[model samples]
Target: MVHKGNCHTQAVCAVATHLPARIHVILKEDRAYELRDLEGRPISKKDAKALIQREYTVPEEIRQRTRGHKKRRRRKEGYIRSQIRGLVTALQASRFA
Candidate 1:
């Protein structure tokens, strides 16, 4: 969670991950844990630093959205399978002939 000192009200930008909504409430508490700003209003900080952790689903989403390259391992497996299929087809054609 990031602090919003610019705003008059005690506010913070809560960035959440793995959440159903792109923007959501990330583990908020009703307690004054932070020191006040110059205006004497308390700084809006999270109770637990661990409260807002990066969501694994986010990177997974990026991986799904991006179609830049084929995974090397999968490509290798496909290549081997393709070679085996080609060899089998060739043998079958010869047997039929």
Candidate 2:
């Protein structure tokens, strides 16, 4: 059985396996230009920040529930943060490592 965290890792590994060896060099040399060229548009820093914030921001319902219970709230927060961190780490490892 695949654990939740390993799902991200495995998916990254699968994609990375199919990529060319020169991908790392291209990523290092002109990462932004390469991405924009492929996408056919430029991405501003503000746009990138907004995209990330939108993707990673926790929902208000989860945040509201934390006010009701101490131990359960902490556990919920930890789980949420861990999942977010795991996704971020996996993405960084796949793209920038």
lDDT of 1 at 3: 25
Model 1: lDDT of residue 83: 100
Cα lDDT tens digits, model 1, 1-97, are 1221222122223322344342233235344345444465554454232233332122444444443344766798899999999999999999999
lDDT of 2 by residue, 1-97 (tens): 1222223456568768867665766686865433232255767777766765665454556545544576787999999999999999999999986
Candidate 2 residue spans exceeding 4 A from truth: 1-40, 64-70, 73-97
Which candidate number maximizes TM-score?
Answer: 1
How many clashing residue pairs are found in candidate 1? 0
Indicate the TM-score of model 1.
0.33
- Model 2 residue 12 CA deviation (Å) reads 11
lDDT measured at residue 89 in model 1 versus the true structure, 0 to 100: 100
Which residues of candidate 1, in runs, are more than 4 Å off? 1-70
Q: Give TM per candidate.
A: 0.33, 0.30
